[model samples]
Target: MANQRGLATPLGVEFAPPHRADRIAALLAEQDRWSPADMPAIHTDTHLGSAAPLLDHLRALKNLSPKAAALRDRLLAWDRRMDAQSTDAAAYAAVRGAVVRRLAAHPAFAALAAPPSCPEVLLPWLALLPRIAFALEHLLLAEELYEIDRSAVVAAALEEVAVLAPAAPWGQSHRLAPWRALATTSDDEPGLAGDHDCVPCTSSVPGLTDLSARGPAARYVWDLARREDSRWVVPFGASGVPGSPHHRDQLPLWVRGDLVQVVTDFEQLTKESDV
Candidate 1:
């Protein structure tokens, strides 16, 4: 909505906004005059600034368990970026997932575990675990009503994470797994860099799988100043046919976060009769 209103620009990075409208507005004002050449910076901005609050909260807490302390120190030392090769991101995600799961299972929240008598479409809202997983930050900072020992959960989760070491980097696990109508085996899909709140959002359900099943199906940068200067790219190619020349031609570009120039000239395209 902000993009549509010219209050912000869509760089094809994050899907859900961080709810920081004021901050985004400031950023928009700062980059009001950005040109098409600056689009690359927008596309590649994968900083995890949104996670700072949670990190700061964790650091300020006292009497953390050894494992939790170690995890906190490692996260604090991190560059605060969710780069593809970042091991810190992987560790952080693992610990966060554990914390969320443990919190959801607490006796205080047991009442919420029962499925609500709502319509099937609204069933997800009644799922207690996912609610905790998605709104972890809020729950962590919010006033505790149910008297749940959040700190204990965090520590236990950290200890568990330390026991079960995740060897892969963030990108190796946090990959883009596009759903295909026809089941096909291919290892060409690229591992992505970014979290649910990062600029380049490659969100996944923590403690489950890091493979992102949802994202921009197609990315585009429309040059309102000059339509001919616009650029776009799809995950695959122009053709839907299995063995067509255009099939999967754009895969390489999409993986690299590159876009192709939009061709508006009909004369440049060959006629079907010619083919």
Candidate 2:
């Protein structure tokens, strides 16, 4: 029963940590310093629905703010260019590589104090940083190229996927998707199949259009003699004070299928909030 993790009868499964993508997320989570060069993280956790906001941004094609319009125009060009390319994975990846280089310089992705940096821009890239560890080990390798970072390919390919398949499928609607997908689900930890990997979606109703509207009301892990080891999380965050960075902070973890560890330790809990 004794092990590095503590005392417990081992189950057949073991859970590991997920990876975080953006450096700006560190600035948001720990109030770390910000640099203009760091591109913000936007829904990088979910390969499927997280980029839906970017799609909506392009829908109002006319009268968008200067930055929004600027970004849209470039994406449109990228969209056309991406579609004309060959399907060989190498060629597909090369196109993305070129597109992302341009994306890096665009104004829409400009680093700001918080999101909503662009006028009339629905997705505030800066404020939208979701500081959650994304477990890339679960992504489907069959259809993806290993040479490129997942986020980079997604950035290059998103416009194409959105323009080609514009519908936002929720919950069980994932089954209808052309590629493999999973519902907003919580399976017993330590054993989620790679193809069936799910996000921490609390509102997984069949027809909902938005995942952010709902979340885990609360989450918990109980510990006995050493009460400090117990952890808890509310829907978003526990920065109970108004406008605390932590108030809406834990959401990314919750959505990306992970949990934050809260210490009840007057009991000296080994703090590992590495989400």
* lDDT per model vs. reference: 0.71, 0.33
lDDT digits (tens) for residues 160-185 of candidate 2 = 43344322222222211111133553
Query: Which residue runs of candidate 2 sit more than 4 Å off their true CA positions?
Result: 1-201, 204-208, 267-275
What's the true lDDT of residue 23 in model 1? Answer: 36
Candidate 2: residue pairs that collide = 19-133, 19-134, 114-127, 115-127, 116-124
Q: What is the TM-score of each candidate against the true structure?
A: 0.80, 0.25
95 Cα displacement, candidate 1 (Å): 1.3
Q: What value of lDDT does candidate 1 attain over all alpha carbons?
A: 0.71
Candidate 1 error regions (>4 Å): 1-32, 65-67, 114-126, 165-167, 184-188, 272-275
lDDT by residue (6-47, candidate 1, tens digit) is: 334555543344533333444557755876555655554567
